[model samples]
Target: MTRCRLCGSEAMASVVDLGATPPCESFLAADRLDQPEPAYPLHLRVCTDCWLAQIPPLITPEETFKEYAYFSSFSTSWVEHARTFVADAVERAELGADAFVVEVASNDGYLLKHVVDRDIRCLGIEPSVNVGAAARDAGVPTLTEFLSPETGAAVRAEHGPANLVVANNVYAHIPDVIGFTQGLRALVADDGWVSIEVQHLLTLIEENQYDTIYHEHFQYYTVASAIRALASGGLTLVDVELLPTHGGSIRLWARPAETAGEPSQAVTDVLAREKAAGLQELSGYTEFSARVAKVRRDLLRFLIEAADRGETVVGYGAPGKGNTLLNHCGIRPDLLAYTVDRNPYKHGRYTPGTRIPILAPEQIAADKPDYVLVLPWNLRAELVEQLAFVHEWGGRLVFPIPELSVVEAASSKEVTA
Candidate 1:
């Protein structure tokens, strides 16, 4: 039986099978091209017992994230998002110089930089050696190792319990969901809160975000399922917020079960809405699978037709989600000439499964392809603005997911006007 990673429930149903794929961010060096890529089964399953959505167990944290290529500081929007999160968290938790804040999967200290600026004690637990070193270089003390129950206890023993534990977009990446949450409980102080931001499954299905599916993302989360998982670890969901980042995400605030407080109305409202939407029923997942299949067909057809028309197409943003979409859709360099990335580390590399070249964003401006495929469709607005010069050559922007559409305007300013 393929049991659930969280509750060990055998009652699970396959939601979507994305087939064999390499780790999304495993961009390869030119010399390593001939090195065999280990592609694993990328299958999503929803646990009937706990309602946690997860992928079939295949890879470990050590295999996936050590010496990671991604740096949070690479994206301007992400950096701004981190800064905003730090400011808001400090204010909401009433954190001061004496209060300690801990962040898990804190990449390159992008968020903790703001916390340190406030003179508050901050520590980052990053598993990737390269990214952790970058964080330390940025003056943020970071521990380089996977965060498990043992590591959490050790951290607490060394630095004391944290007043706030921030985990942004990491709740779903862990294969051992239970262990990770237990670690949170062990590290947080009595009054401290653990804030987790995950891409909401409900939003993923509704927005046709099948691109977010990959081996690295071991699970998909919804508030109801997350609450249950947290409860199992002696944590309670006290508050929740719907965030616009990463397509659509939910920021959930939790505390130890012993803490006394009423759950936020946001929690009750979203849960009730989810229940009404039949997320509690297996039928919801079935419908989602059907919708995902349709999107795959639509995207492939559009790309094939565009190729036949001799239209030059290129991808923007070498995000993990983009890799999943391309690999699942079986897109290669022939379909997309190359993908552009702002991260210098990834620029000269090749995408994992598709082996498509990744270049600097400057390539998009210089090439000025007839069509620029916006892989991170969630940031379409921001990217379209950034590439406004493409209009000079009468090039159009294409967004495949959610729906296929060609956006044409002289410039971003003209489009808004």
Candidate 2:
């Protein structure tokens, strides 16, 4: 944290100190409940020189990804997003059957299945053994290996350079920002396109999405800083697309410097927006910590009030971000009761630090909790529709981020903060 991960600058400014929490995805089994758990400082800092927001590399990708619990296929909306992205990328990149596509951190082949459907030769470099095996079982050719510079070169040398390299939702996971970017550069053809999607720091701050801050995400990016990060590996920012995934994300289209003519007008527009938000300077981050505090306070107040009223409250998703929210707000099983998730892997496991019991999604319907706290608020629209049946029991859905919001399950109307 003393030096910026992207730039070696020693001048780092505090963004928000989320105190300490265990690795967000480290769900505890029943036997481990009595054992001691480790925690790390979760402070976020921005490089004054590069304006790149990052946390200390207390945990390594190997520790987190080797036996990963998260599988992208569990979320239907995310799967559809990947399908649509593959179609769009294929058309945009002019990829054909003979073309080879590579995806970094391709979790459970959520995306490459689309590429395979089109008869396009593709490979998935996935770090997680379990999820990677699942990907292979799903008929997507996957390499169970992390993407280092050497790994990238070996892949290119064996299978030939990739026509399109797709990295979505993982650009922020690696601690070695520069080396990971270089690995990406090594995977793609000299003139090939590299499509990367990462959560935009602008929406993260603007929408009070502090829950997204966790150990897994090593760094946050603004277009201004992203341009600099991409340049470190000889990649040039070409075009950018603003996406609605994971609250808000940026789909960065980049290429090798030699063939990357000039950045699109979209890049200019996003940079302008970032600048207008004062993200290039300390002004943009000054109010974020206060806003994050308000979110925590508002959420805790609602959960406490609900418990006082003898009403039941449960969480909807056991996402990593939800752990951060639960830990930061000091919510335990007493306040939330028990949360339900569609992912069966988390059904019998307890949340990392908060120790909230995770049940199957059917538990919500079976128990008929008065309030269902939506942890993965980024998928608000999708979850709201899916959980509409909660209204049958007069249940309401509570969203903790972007301010506390209580919406009627049936009418989908806002109740109160």
Candidate 3:
């Protein structure tokens, strides 16, 4: 029996099974077209004891993050988000020129750029060499290695305890959740704050965003699960904020258990809400597998119908979640002519498993496809607004998850009018 990764509980409940799929980033080279792709079972389960939702134990961090293709500087929205976070954190934490800041998985120095501008000492722990190189080039000193207790100790030895530790969209990617958070306890100063941003598990379930499932994202988190995980490492959650990024996300502010801060009402309210929603109960996870299967079927049916109707359907956002959704639904370039990505690195490459070419957003204007499918549905508003010119040509945007919907100019006017 597979034991829970976090709580060591054998009484785990099956949540959703996404079936076998290749790593979301394994976009093959043209020469390797004939090679067979490696696929693994993408089963997800939730621990009954600790309420942590995670994928089956299989891949290692070395296999996932090494040579990572994702660069945080690619997305304009993400860059802006990071800048805003750095600004807000500096003020809230009362960071000064002497203060030290550490960011885990700090790709391309997206947030650290802002921190360093204030002359504060900063260090970045990044696993991917290419992205880490980018961070170094951007004038941020980065250590290209995975964040573990050993690395944390090394960081503490080199830089002393950090006054601020920021981990954005990375807490879920780690497998050794306890050890990683313990490392945070080791690296952060006694009076320091550690802020982590993770996509909310409640939003995933309610919005039917099963596409976020992949080998890299080992865990899905709720406020209750987060509290449990942090408490295991002797940390106390002092604040929580609901963020609109990534469909929906939660930003948690924590510190050492010995130091006290006024816990926000948002934190308490969300915990109580999670309890009322049966997040800590076993039955909450029982029927999730069925819901996921239904989504797969519905999405496939919609895509097939669109293809039959001679729709020139394409995709937006070449993100990891987009890759999982495409691979899960078995979509190919035949169904989606190509995908547009803001990331210049991914622009010239093809999507993994699906083999769909990724292009720049300018290609949308050049081709004027009949339909633009929003893959990163979380950023649908930003994408739709940016690609509004497509609507001028009577082209519509399609979103498959939750349900397939068409956003035509007429419909847009109706909503606004």
Q: Which candidate comes out best when scored by lDDT? A: 2
Mind giving the per-residue lDDT tens digits that candidate 3 earns over 243-345?
9888889999999999946688999999887787777896666666677778778777767887899878888888888888888888898889999887777
What residue pairs are clashing in model 3?
none
Q: Give the TM-score of candidate 2.
A: 0.99
Query: Could you tell me every candidate's TM-score relative to the true structure?
Result: 0.96, 0.99, 0.95
lDDT of 1 by residue, 278-361 (tens): 777887788777888887888788778889999899988888888888888899988899989888888789999899999988
The order of the candidates by TM-score, greatest first, is 2, 1, 3
lDDT of each: 0.86, 0.94, 0.85
For candidate 3, the clash count comes to 0
Clashing pairs in 1: none
Candidate 1 vs candidate 2, lDDT winner:
2
Which ranges of candidate 2 are over 4 A from the true structure?
Answer: none
Q: Give the TM-score of candidate 3.
A: 0.95
